[model samples]
Target: MTRLGYQVPNFTYPGVGSDGLFEAVAAQAVEAEESGFDTVLVMDHFYQLPMLGAPDNAMIECYTLLAALSQRTSRVRLSALVTGNTYRHPSLLAKTVTALDVVSGGRAQLGIGAGWFELEHDSLGFEFGTFTERFEKLEEALRIVIPMLRGERPSLEGTWYSVHEAINSPAPVGRIPVMIGGGGEKKTLRMVAQYADESNIICAPDEIPRKLAALDEHCERLGRDRSEITVTYQTSAVIAPTKEQAQAELDAAVAAIPELAARAGGVILGSPDEVRPIYERILASGVDGVTVNLPANGHVPGRVALLGETLAPVVNRS
Candidate 1:
């Protein structure tokens, strides 16, 4: 199945307390599941970025949101966009997710990647180190996280982390998919091939074919079937009624995110009809899924509902 999922970055809002944020997001999450979205992701960030809002804006902790989302949505898989390796020990993360999985009735997956947001690290008083070092810690964290989740005895004495007798009380019944997020070639893909059940990439529609080829090569090196590791890419989609309107919305969003505008990769800016061809193009790229990051203006729920109500049929047909 060419599954379609929605990613909610939980950008921000003009809210003061958790009541408004929780009610709003939970409503959307339930709507997403009923709308037929395969999964729902909440961003893992300590603080809202400058682009989104001030540092102390309406933001919920990742795990707390996941716990609430677990109770609220029945079918939609819930996860962090990618949790920081530095935030918690692998064993603690394992136990947390085990309880989440149990509470959510096995509707949880772990989306983990090397942490990159410097402001989040600095603001939270987390040690912000060099990229290489962070990636190194990510590699070590994966070693610990995977084993603990699999009910294996985990003992790792790496440069960044050391854990002995790492364990979980209740192991997840099914292998909870470990999703690695990044578009890097050398280190990220190699590690995904070695350990991950899924891999996420960010690139233009034109670049996907090549990154996929690299991932396939990495799979071959690891002697794993490319099909076994689900292939999914992250894309920003601006949906409008007409081509002209969609382009206008795209311009508005690009103006909002100049850095993203400068990058030509994975922006699906068009009406549903125009974007239909793009989804077909990605479907032909040998991926199992496509995660559509919709516009988070007031109509996010409506937009996602429209996708599930409208575009999802097309996605399934492909």
Candidate 2:
């Protein structure tokens, strides 16, 4: 269930240009693995989202980057932070992630969600459906993806999709865990109860207990045990050797993205001594683990290492 995962959502590094983009990403992936991160995720987007930067900012295709990452690292699980279900065909995505599992020695996880970035869809000429339509597509997509992942050829005809005994060959070496990412109370959690192996909730720390309780309700209504699903949280974080430096990093982040000021409480800050208690509280709240983006200083070689060596043990223990 991803004990301590690291996500590399920002591709725009300080010194690395386009030519060295992958090298920079690989460097971080390797460092994350060395730092005790069990899973490493890259966002699935054709262009950088507004939260990160402009549309023209460096962004790589998700499956391609993951395939490349599979070659660069041996142990860490590779996947998209959450694949946009609208961008590619469900059958094709099944094959892609299966290939990733094959090449990465079965250390691949499929993290997917209802596609949400309108800009990418409009610019890339993909259908930008309404929210309800996207969720419908996601539910349909899971019907196809789950069976294919289990080495089945499903012939399905639904309101949103159609497949005729579509096959996935050279299937995953072992069962590839499917993670449905979102915090939608009604639809998303219900889908997780019915289908997903894991669920990633993205919300403020204060909101986690409520989210978990809602998920539990969804599971009970579906006659499923909540324990069947591994629950993880996704958020940005700031960690340093000292509290002052961590605060400075947090301040810089908030200054860069003014909206972050309000969400600062959710961002893990300060030294390991300080951060561990925050993590402990999160764990106590029933969160199985966390996936963090260290965009502020991930490019700095040793920052990830310090996070791993200092904070990982605490999370692991929890």
TM-score against native, each model: 0.88, 0.94
Candidate 1 matches the true fold with a TM-score of: 0.88
Q: Which TM-score value belongs to model 2?
A: 0.94
Q: How many backbone overlaps does candidate 1 show?
A: 2
**Every candidate's lDDT:** 0.74, 0.86
Clashing pairs in 2: none
Best by TM-score: 2
lDDT of 2 by residue, 263-285 (tens): 56656777888877777787778
The true-versus-predicted C-alpha distance at residue 139 of model 1, in Å, is 1.1
| Model 1 C-alpha lDDT per residue in residues 1-318, reported as the tens digit of each score | 116777775445434255577777776677677777888887788786554445765567888889888888888888877787778777788887777788889888898888887888877788879999988988988888888888897898888888988867788856688888887888888888888988888776678888788888999988988877877878767676676766665566556554335432445766677877778778787777788766433234466665666557666676
